[model samples]
Target: MSIQTGDKIPAVTLKVMGEKGPQDITSEEIFAGKKVVLFAVPGAFTPGCTMTHLPGYIVNADKIKAKGVDTIACISVNDAFVMDAWGKSQNAEELLMLADGNGTFTEALDLVMDGSGFGLGNRSRRYAMIVEDGTVSHLALEPTGAVDVSAAEKILALL
Candidate 1:
């Protein structure tokens, strides 16, 4: 089943680009004691994600953090290298770029989106969630191919 507002974040490992290159981070470490806003896109650097979805977060990141959020992160099914490059390209220094390269974390959350038709294989559906110390308090899942409810503006509004 898909993750719900009351669900705890699943146990899985994700990647992030560090100075030493890709590094592994556990889900527990990310949410265990933090108020986090995590948004997931289908892929990194895709048209919608690049031009629209991520930019909304980039612009509103401080405003969201001011509302008591500890971290704002973006995740995609792409590799850490791609996510890192995209973050650099967008000047997303304020956000954490998480890479669910193998889609393991996405699958653990039951939020997998089939992208075989697009030659993208398994990917994550567009969604955003407010996680507090390991438990999700709010979840906004976007419709297929849409970027409405999961946009940063909406997440900011919720905050």
Candidate 2:
């Protein structure tokens, strides 16, 4: 079943490119006892992703954090290397770009999108969630092939 309100974050290791280096952070470590805004995208560097999805979050990171969020994260079904480069390209130094390289975390949350049309294989659907202390509090799931629902403004409005 898809994750719903009050569902705990899946216990999976997320690869992150931190200042020190690539580090493996577990869901518990990230979500436990913290309020987080976690957004997922199909892939990094894609058109809609680059122009609208990521930039919205990047520009509104401070506002989101001011709404009692501990951190803002962006996840994609790409490797740590790709996410790292994309973060730099987008000037997303403040957002935590997580590499769900294996899509294990995506599948576990029931959010992976089938990308057979583009031959990209399975990926994550665009969505954003408000997580509080390891459980989902609110979710803004985008419609298939649509981008509006998961925008930062939408998430902020939900908050």
My TM-score estimates for the predictions, one after another, are 0.98, 0.96
Give a tens-digit lDDT track for model 1, residues 46-135. 999999999999999999999999999999999999999999999999999999999999999999999999999999999999999999
Off by over 4 Å in 1: none
CA shift of 70, model 1, Å: 0.6
User: Candidate 2 residues 1-159, lDDT tens each?
Assistant: 889888889899989987787889899888999999999999999999999899999999999989899989999999998999999999999898999999999999999899989988999988999999999998888988788978999999888
Per-residue error (Å), model 1, residue 104? 0.6
Model 2 TM-score on a 0 to 1 scale: 0.96
Model 2 residue 13 CA deviation (Å) reads 0.5
Question: Whole-model Cα lDDT per candidate?
Answer: 0.95, 0.92
What is the overall TM-score of model 1 with all chains considered together? Answer: 0.98
